[model samples]
Target: MATPTAVVVGVGAERGLGAALCRHFAREGYHVLVAGRTAEKIEAVARGLKDLGLSAKAVLTDATVEADVVRLFDEAMSPGFGRDPSDLVVFNAGNNRQLDFRELSAEQFEDFWRVGCFAGFLVGREAARRLVPLGRGTLIFTGASASLRGKPGYAQFAAAKAGLRMISQSMAREYGPLGLHVAHVVVDGGIDGERLLKNRPEAKAARGEDGLLGIEAIAESYWHLHKQRRSAWTQELDLRPFKESF
Candidate 1:
């Protein structure tokens, strides 16, 4: 039998969730395609995995661009050698910031939407197009707390996330019976990753042990979602630290 393959989009720092997912899937014996905007970051991730005796390759991709997304799927669906086309794919591209509604520029709002929502749509649509015909595959989207509620300075973020959530929902309902497992994962708290810790050095101390979401732990959930039985598939799952409030 041919070896399986997986594709993880939006990979960045080695310590981030996207990298964690790549590591986990590679460890599980899948040839992984690490896709992200930064050549250095994604290449480093693939090289690191290779050093650890795993199979992986880096594909430079801008998730918001349709052509880039199509090219990525082309590689994923036709990974060379004995590896089978990717049946597991993840859309984990997004950013967040708090800005006063009164001062937020239109460009800023559109930028956020382009990355946070538009990118997910492109990935989700491509996944549906490719995976639905195969009659088997898993496509997961990384969502946020903003997917469920809007806060004072998070209008743009909330709108983007909520839209992505809806896209995931629509895909699940439309394709679940056809054999595609579509899931949306709501990450509800500060991730214990480089982005948060570097920006706020005191975050780990403030949150206490396990107060922030562990990157590996979150990745484990995604793995489970992909492994779930079709008879009992999960369409949506939420992950948060024990101390995080809803």
Candidate 2:
């Protein structure tokens, strides 16, 4: 069998959990596809991986764009990447747009739907079309806590992510019998990085003695779910800090 290819969409050049996912999978001997909106940003991340002598490539792609999404997966299934049908596809798109719902405009709501929900649906649909015929593959979503329940101030964001969770369950039920592993992850714990420092400086200072969950650890969780046999499959996984309540 050919080596597995792992494609991660909406990757980041800065401190991103998805970037860490790329590294972890590559280290495990999977060809990594680092995709994002900007060519420069994608190239920078892919270069870092290539420098480490790992099998990784960067593609400038907008996950929200149908053409881009279709083309990216099509290329991944090509001969160059050794596209094993059983390879993993990690859907890690969307970013939090801080906007109060009381003042949330139609544009804000539409933007959230487009980036968070629509992109995921399109990506998942494309992957299903491509992988179903191949017999088996893993579809993973990197989600947030709000994905489960709607929150007071985070309506738009929560709704969008909730759509992804619903789709995950639907896909899992429909495709699980066909050897497809569909899993949704709720990463409730805060991640440590400069972004954390920039957003919550006080939290960072307080947690100096106790760090947040590392990206590599999170990646391992996804890998664990992907590798689990049907009898032991985890349909959903949620991770929160030990000190966290609720």
Candidate 3:
């Protein structure tokens, strides 16, 4: 029997949720394929995981590009790698730029959709192609509050995330009976990370103790989603800080 393999897209920084997911999956004994556009960052993350005696490799990729998405799966299933059809695939690539409704350009809106929705479709389709035959796999999409509601100045981000949410739901219905688990997770609070602290110091102060969402906790939830029995699969889940309203 081959070891399970996991693919994680959009591993932006060490402190972000994507990276956290990679670490958790790696610790669980899955050979993790870290996919992202930034070569340096992804490689650094892979190296760190390797240092911990975990199986990990960096696959520099732009998830928004069809060619790149295709290449990503090819590399994962390549003979040399000997990775079984990805046991877990996560579509975590997202573009969250706040633009006033009036200022949001068609191109900008499409860009978000390209990363947040189209890329997910590409990855999910490929993953299903492989998993359907084997009769098992898990696909997870990282969503946000925007996935549920559109806020002012976030027209583009909201639209894209909403599209992703629908895609996850549709896939869950279509593939659940085929032995594949598809889930969408909504992160509803500011994640406690260096980037968040640097950008919004006041948010940290306002959140109080355990007010910010911890990336590790989020990763743990994702692991739980993957381990769920077929009889009780979770199609969607929402995570937020204790202080978050609603």
Could you say which candidate leads in TM-score? 1
Per residue, candidate 1 scores C-alpha lDDT tens digits across 209-242 of 9999999999999999999999999999999998
Each prediction's Cα RMSD? 0.7, 1.7, 1.4
Question: All models: lDDT?
Answer: 0.95, 0.82, 0.89
Q: Which stretches of candidate 2 lie over 4 Å from their true place?
A: 81-86
Q: Spell out the clash pairs found in candidate 1.
A: none
TM-score of each: 0.99, 0.94, 0.96
Error of 1 at 100 (Å): 0.9
Clashes of 3: 0
lDDT of 1 at 110: 98
Could you give candidate 3's per-residue lDDT for residues 1-246 as a string of tens digits? 666789999897888888999999999989999999999889988999999999899999998788898888887766254566577889999878678888778888889889888888888888887777778989999999999999889888888899999989988898899999999999998999767877888987887999999999999999999999999999999999877998
Candidate 2 clashes between residue pairs 3 or more apart in a chain or in different chains: none
CA shift of 197, model 2, Å: 2.8
